[model samples]
Target: MKRFLSGFLIGTAATVAAAASVVLTVKKQVIDPIDEQQVAHDEKRKRAMRKSAAR
Candidate 1:
């Protein structure tokens, strides 16, 4: 019983750690680039609007 409990706890911890790392990696690789692109696009759109307004 003790051995089984220990194994279960260890497995749970490892799964949690792996899930956290995957989330972090996805945020770094995917979310960050998408966010950066959106920011740049918004800035460009704002600039275009201002230019048209000026004209």
Candidate 2:
């Protein structure tokens, strides 16, 4: 019983740690400012090209 409990606790801890790491990574991607700026610049450039083509 003791061995089973120990293994269960270790597995639970590892699973929690992995989940936390994944959450942190997702949060960082969602909150990153540089990515937002790059996306906006790309969109603006695309719009400019489309306008020039229409002329």
Q: In model 1, which regions exceed 4 Å deviation?
A: none
Alpha-carbon deviation at 25 in model 2, angstroms: 0.5
In angstroms, the error of model 1 at 44 is: 0.3
Scored against the true structure, residue 30 in model 2 reaches a CA lDDT of 74
Range of the 10 consecutive residues with the lowest summed lDDT in candidate 2: 26-35
**TM-score quality measure for candidate 2:** 0.55
**What TM-score, to 2 decimals, does candidate 1 have?**
0.92
Candidate 2 residue lDDT tens string, 22-44: 99898787767678889999999
